[model samples]
Target: MPIVARANLSPASREEHLARLESATLEYPLDVLVIGGGATGAGAAFDAASRGLDVGLVEAGDLASGTSSRSSKLIHGGLRYLQMLDFTLVAEALRERDLLLTRTAPHLVRPVSFVFPFARKVIDRVFIGSGVALYDTLQSLGRRRAVPLHRHLLHDKLMTVFPALDGSKLAGAVEYHDAQVDDARLVMMLARSAALHDAAIATYTRVIDYVREDGRVIGVKARDEETGHEFVIHAREIILATGVWTQEQQEIAEAETGLRVLASKGIHITVPKDRIPAKAATGIITQTEKSVLFLIPSDEYWIIGTTDTPWTEDVAHPAATAADIEYVLDHANEILASDLTREDVIGVYAGLRPLLQPVSKGEKAASASTKVSREHTVMTIEPGLTAVAGGKLTTYRVMAEDVVDHAIRDSFPDRPSLTASLPIVGAQGYRELTAQRSEIARIREYDLVRVDRLLGRYGALLPEVMALIDTDPSLGEPLEGDERYLRAEVVYAVRAEGARHVADVLMRRTRSDYEVADRGAGAAAEVAALMAPELGWDAEREALEAETYRAHIAARLAGEQARDDASAAAALADAPEVPRRA
Candidate 1:
């Protein structure tokens, strides 16, 4: 089969994908049916399709709406994992990280430096420095070193590197490199690449049940959440990449024997970049009572997080409690020149990591989720059903390869994974476009900074977005509430990026939600009005969409104020749910 170039995920493409889903087995069954739209699922779809396998992927919500979008956004070899002495896992992740930075998605992934601050001089320096040296060594084992090696800095130099640090501590620091990315965009690019390879990709499509015959799973019964239409998609093999919802899916399928997945809720708070007086993308690794915490720096914000506590709340909306916020703020403030309070936080987001339930019995069973292995497991639950769980974002490509290779082991025994060599949708000519960024900016009459931002987000696909601007000069204007985003990007989200809801554009397609103080509430109405026509929403529907988004933001803020998870859940429950299409 020849590769086709209709890679756009416009409304028309979604309709086409839905039409194909309705007629899946009637025409012919797919070789593989993937259930998830996260990094793992998208990667699997692209991997399977690239190898000439007929595949279809379904997600109950927007692509990367779950944990994939809420990550700390680093692609590292897991320095903490090295403390556990997991050499193989670290090497594999480093290899995948290098592939992404250099070959697969250079535009989405870039090199970032982190400062490992040390308070206890000599002992701390040797301990952290040795681990970082090992990390650099493993990265060098890859085909190319995508980032720089680790360097040692004394207390004075460390203070120079991060002026935000408290001089009272007056300790040395180790600077090391890791790759960071827009996690949601990476998943979106994967799905688009899969669609370009002829894979049927459908979002807001929920798998209600499994299609079973003679005790062997054969396909899935899915519901199109957009139109409330139910359909059966037959496939020779089914791969379940659902993360935190894996256990729920297992129950729906009535799979008595399979890997059990536990959900560990992690939350991150975003503060304005100016609050952190840092010239570079700096991160600090500190030990929490339960697990380690990370304070990673992004372009215009500092993402401070992550409390690893067990969660037993609604999976869709994991609320971040006052305790969670305080935990992060307290630890993060420990090393800062100025303290960060709840008032300083502009945005907060929570995600659940789908950890595999450890096989330990009795008292050992009470181990913290952090102690659970980060390695992924592939299990053939039944004749035609396969499921994968417990891997990090950096190694998603390898996880996809493992799942696909296992699913097709009997059918296509000789076929090997080709994703390592395949550049995702926007990566093909990215370098050339980046080199010509100044020329493109001159021709388009935009500033060099604007063009550079576009290249960072779109890469070779920049022309496609520029075409939207050319069609409507108004699109070239900045969004009303947030000057960092262009109006054209909003239209592009709906017209080309498979964005079906107002929240999708605000939260994922653009960083308006977390970047601004109002949590995107200020831009809600404008965005809804812009998307109304394309999504076929009437005035009332548009109003409802805008109102629902505001409620969501309000609820999230209220949740953050609540003292505990239960109270946070109640506060989050205040948000009126967006009515799905019937």
Candidate 2:
């Protein structure tokens, strides 16, 4: 039988989690308290909870609202790290990648082939080809290969593979495989799995300061960002997984020394897939002056981006400037049959990478932000407080295990982490359920295309969505003004996925915000109406939620008009926030 995991998160669960924190004290404290709700933090909660530890996690915003959601959404062995000669990182990441594709999240992650167009004939093939060969070799070392091996394509074959290429500037191409994932969904699933293991999970709860003992960290003073209610959470050990905010969090704990983390900004723009014709290709990547440019596929649209530069502005609201958008378009147009203009862009987003500096060498080792390693670092900020930062989405599991291991090394010395072998909430029966997709759609009276899409998102738990439809047949209809998503999805985001605001349901729970031209503004009122009754919001509150969603989108659109990071961030500052639910 598949592992039984049917957990749900709602406002009631949030209240329960908060009560657990409020009731715990010195005599009865949680074994581990995790701060941050991004990928690594959620993973740490899963790791600790699975090991039979009393775990409690708190987040300042919705899950994956930070760097976790803003990723390129690719899960690979860090193909770029091979050039840096980080063989161990590549090999370890490859193992994890295979695990996700096969064992853990077969539904959310799938292999994507990328063709690297050759600029020079011999030198490019010999150098880049050998590097790709090594990338495959490392994957072969794992128990099983998640994706296929690399292949070299001649002129005719390369053109057949990717017809969009200009063909005039390229000699040939080499194709290799990597995986893409639903970044925010993965984090949410991880949190749900942890909750199933008896972990107390809370979001929109910010840790204000450390509750310390005689020169040792013991607990935290926190506030409910949604209600402004202050409380204390007592824990034996506190794990800080606050990516770019690591230093800021350390200051709150009043630690003597901590890991020095620098913020590197990366941005992505979405465009209609038909704009760039690729008859036989999933995507393509090419070398850029600063970083490698990727044209990855995501559903109906293509996600193309990634400008890696130093970010000295706000970490909370990273926005893509006009210059950043122009840089991506120019690079993408370099090899495309037709040049892309600003009108081709459907949406844009910017996220910060926690570029961790080497703890051994201190903070001044690297001058360029691009030169910094994407690897993670875990340090004992003090006696009982530990902080971890850096590392990409591909290696979040490893980072989680490492952080949890640090938390329990002295306390639960005999316990071991069960995450590597344990499947997440929706992974166990996912394949079987997928085989029954047509039957599922037939019984539920859903479109075949709609069922297929939801399966990719929910896996074995697709039935849970069906159950929602059974209770309220109206939810089975397409989301108002956004036919791409079902109304049930919005309701699920609240009743099961812990979405509190309209933005939470529209943006993170579903991709309606970025996948659409208006960024889901047209659907804001409808989405708010679906969530209002579930969240106990009055008519005025529902209107406020809808307006806040629209205002935030306006702020992002205004930010996109800026040419620099400072101005873009300033524009984003005008974005209205979700009001406290007191």
Candidate 3:
């Protein structure tokens, strides 16, 4: 593999990106300006820049702060879509899944087996077996092998594999492979890779309006949410990958983008891994009164969720109500021998899915979000503006490719996407590093497990993290509260990963926010102090950062106790906002 040129996504780099954003002009228009710094936007920046185009991307919040961070964290070919007879969507997602597992982000994405327990006997055995068989077949069509083929397990065998499972109700089980990822980290890596390729990227830079000339979008008027600095970013082409905020962006443009996105709220709750008692990532497809429920296995925790219902409230902060928690618990308790109560849940999160509104007349929208198609659509909102909506996390790269391809069709007719073969920042040489993990651990004076953990998170970039440890031996020590993460990781988040706020480091950069029972409150002060120097924060500012994060956590807890969305949103509003510069 060839070594790709990479850039550090540090505070210094963010300053440079902001400088470029402030200086953009119509006379010197960027080849592509991407809106939304989530997965798709970051991917588009990388895709366009890798193809030798000058690209710039802006995000209102931290990368993956929206729907991207709140995903189920599974990079699977939507297995449920197959039941809807959407084979094309499943195939495309599977191809992308395999690409991430094998070529693109092998370190971040790895194969995880899912045990789909079946309660119904004859009908389910035939229907689900065939569906999974087709799922495997589609994966085989891909160039690389990501995971093993699906296999049917008898009830007796299933019980042996999953002792915690109450096999009394289960007739059998079908075990299949899918992939899991740290979704937020993937977005950050994409942005970092784009920066390496010379694409200007800035976060907390909100697009206030479009820069229009003759009814065509040539750029955007943006405001830095942190600094309160507003400016114009000139670009020859603009792509919107704003997900649930798609319609909002169109409204700002004041042009009919010919796209309508309905926001559907999905909420997930996290518990300790021991609470679920699953050896592998286990899931049972049981019908809820409203939708299906999935109990996914993440590292050190079991994430069970998601209530799919219409969300008409604020998209920025979708709160999980008491009812949402009850819904998940009620459905999850159906198959488990031990019932899960509210006390068992350590963390709760809610995100909105942007479902493309069907256009045909007389097409009644289904009340259940499961019925909505996961397919994406790209449209020309104007001469220079293009927008994409309604895609899943697994297909973000493909969505990015499509949006960029469309946006640059007329301008750069000959240049094609190069991200298909491009490995993300940490992916290159990851495998070799993993093979030498023990040796590296010995040299670094750390245990093999610690080295393995770092490799999983940073891949071949582990050395970069280790360099921080070398400079400050205290960084090698475990974080005060979370032993799973090192103090070094927190510093690296600020120094090399463009983490500006305390929440950005604890919540997205590390899973400490949800992985631990305290939701990162225990480590908040320490993490904030570590980032203070890098971000040029005074002692007062550092204290405020810690206080803000604590308030945010408290608000999230209060929201979880609320009975409905309205009350939940109200409770979440209690959190203090980050102070902006005047």
Q: Give the whole-model CA lDDT for all candidates, comma-separated.
A: 0.87, 0.88, 0.86
Clash pairs, candidate 3, are none
Highest-TM-score candidate? 2
TM-score per candidate: 0.97, 0.97, 0.96
Q: Write the per-residue lDDT of candidate 1 for residues 170-194, one digit (tens) a residue.
A: 5798899888898898999899999
In what order do the candidates fall by lDDT, top score first?
2, 1, 3
List runs of model 2 lying over 4 Å from the truth. Answer: 1-6, 358-367, 580-582
Q: Give me the overall lDDT of model 2.
A: 0.88
- Report, for all candidates in order, the number of backbone clashes: 0, 0, 0
Per-residue CA lDDT of candidate 2, range 432-489, in tens?
Answer: 9989989988887877888878998999888888888889999989977678888998
Give the winner by lDDT: 2
Q: 1-582 in candidate 3: lDDT tens per residue?
A: 123324677787788888887787888989999999899999999999999998999998888988999888889898888778898999999999998998999989988887778878888888888888999998898366679988999888888767667778899888888888999999999998998899888988999999889888999999888878889999999999999998899899987645788899999899888887755656545556766677777767788877889987778778898888998988888888888998998888888889987655357766666667789999999889999998999999999999999999999989988887899999999999999988998888878877877888999888888888889999889988688899999998987787889899888999777888889988999998888888899999999899888888888888888888888887766674354454
Q: Which wins on lDDT, candidate 2 or candidate 3?
A: 2
| Clash pairs (backbone) in predicted model 2 | none
Candidate 1: misplaced stretches above 4 Å? 1-5, 360-367, 574-577
